[model samples]
Target: MSFVIAVDGPAASGKGTVASGLARELGLPHLDSGLLYRAVGRALQVAGGDPDDAAAATETARRLDPHDLEDPALRTREAGEAASRVAVHAGVRAALLDFQHAFAAQEPGAVIDGRDIGTVIAPDAPAKLFVTASPEVRAHRRWLQLKDQGVSLDEILADIALRDERDSARSTAPLVQAKDAVLLDTSEMTIEQAADAARRIVEAARARWETSLKGEASQKG
Candidate 1:
């Protein structure tokens, strides 16, 4: 039985950082599934394709090179906005689903983070977390990150709001907490605290998994 940890959250909610930290702690592979959408968006932009064209985006997503997806340029606000726009396309989401699932299947276990990881991408994952924070807090965090990169604070805040609206309003895979997912509100938690809380959740899930396996073995015997 493969173990998977699905971390879902909105932009700047700290899911990515927490997921990465948990994966490192557990010696597991980590997948930032948002990068898959960003990669498709970037590829579409490079091809001069229409961001609203679902078919074009899906085709681009199907052939995306994971290597090209890691370019630092994808981290820019423009790329993020474009990615959010393209993410509304159902076809594009479908195209990348299998790739995300395949990554989660890697042995020992794997951690995947994105808006829909717990709900859409890895619904069966034993450990599912929905990390979130107030919009103001999230905006402030994004503002600080962009400020370090020389982007204006006002522009960063505006971009954050716009991205939040788009992500929450998208028709396909709109950002929402999965019914069975454990919610972690990070509004008052430091990164270290949030990561530690997430680690505890995963540890509890791991314990359950082991006990279940032991029961199965006893039944077989």
Candidate 2:
């Protein structure tokens, strides 16, 4: 049935939680595409290669195993910084493109979450969601997760805002919502509420697609 769910959002926007929860409920494979860049960054860091070296980053990305993507350290601030740098490299992005696409085409369905899933990775996906929240709200959520006591509030907010600018301003596969994606503003909503909304949107689209198919079959008959 090739049902694909593309979920896109900036960091700490609740798309990851909603996408993971939705994938569990729907029994589909979930791919966190951002992790690809994170994995490459971590690998390069481990190998003592420079993140700014496009050739090294591209090689690291191409050789990245699924196990590399599973590193718990990939979630660190240093890894995020490394990823942001290398992800802007054209060669690095080209190297990892196939892996994301293959993951998105798995058996019955798949759910992909990233800043560019809807815009670049899975433009043909039937269901697309753009999750977002105000910078203050997202910053608070991120601060809670990192729990860095020494960092000032202004630092945290500025970091988040900087990441937003870097992500959106990048020339390659910049983070922007597909025109047809359903916007999910989770500024005031719980993760459960967001997941419920995502499920409803995908289900309704599936129903419409199925109905259209049945209509065609009837016409042929």
Candidate 3:
């Protein structure tokens, strides 16, 4: 079986950065799962479809091309909101499940980062991280990323709070930490510090995983 590292968290929580670092450190491919949803949402928006319409969102997700993931529009604030909205539908999630699963099944291993990766997408992953930070800290990071847009820090904080509620309260595949996952709070940490901490956590998990595999092999022998 391939090694899968599941990194999950809410918006702007540094999960994406940490996941990328892990992939590079482990020599694995990294998949930003949120981009899938963002692409679906952007496509639906382009088609004049409402995100609240489950059928429309599901259809948009079904037709989503892997190429769409590279569209720069998907990185905008509007795209993020739309993604969160469409993500509430179970149908939309089902439509994108295969794409995510295929990425995680690649040879060698893979790193997947998203809200539900640990809880729903890759529950059996040997290494799982629930990365998070205070809303203010997350908002600050997001503001720095989009500061040129002239958006106020307060507005950014409000949006983060709204997304948090929507993501956590959604009925399907809500943002949550799996019981076996380690939590990394980056509220007061720099990017380098967080990356180093994440490396340590994954290294520990990998050791345990190797040991378990060896134990199983001995029992079989």
lDDT values of the candidates?
0.87, 0.87, 0.94
Consecutive 10-residue window with the lowest summed lDDT within model 1? 145-154
Residue range with the least summed lDDT across 10 consecutive positions in model 2: 147-156
Best by the lDDT measure: 3
User: Residue 62, candidate 1: how far off, in angstroms?
Assistant: 1.1
Full candidate order by lDDT, most accurate first: 3, 1, 2
lDDT of 1 by residue, 52-155 (tens): 89899989998988797679888877678779988999999998988887897888779999998888888889899999998788888887766777787677
Off by over 4 Å in 2: 148-152, 215-221
Candidate 2, residues 135-215, lDDT tens digits: the string is: 999888877867764656666688889888988999999989899899999999987788788889889877876787789
- What would the per-residue lDDT of candidate 3 be over residues 98-124, giving only the tens digit for each residue? 999999888878999999999888899
Please say which candidate is ahead in lDDT: 2 or 3. 3
Task: Tell me which of candidates 1 and 3 scores higher on TM-score.
Answer: 3
Residue 140, model 1: Cα distance from true site in angstroms: 1.3
For this target, which candidate reaches the highest TM-score against the unseen true structure? Answer: 3
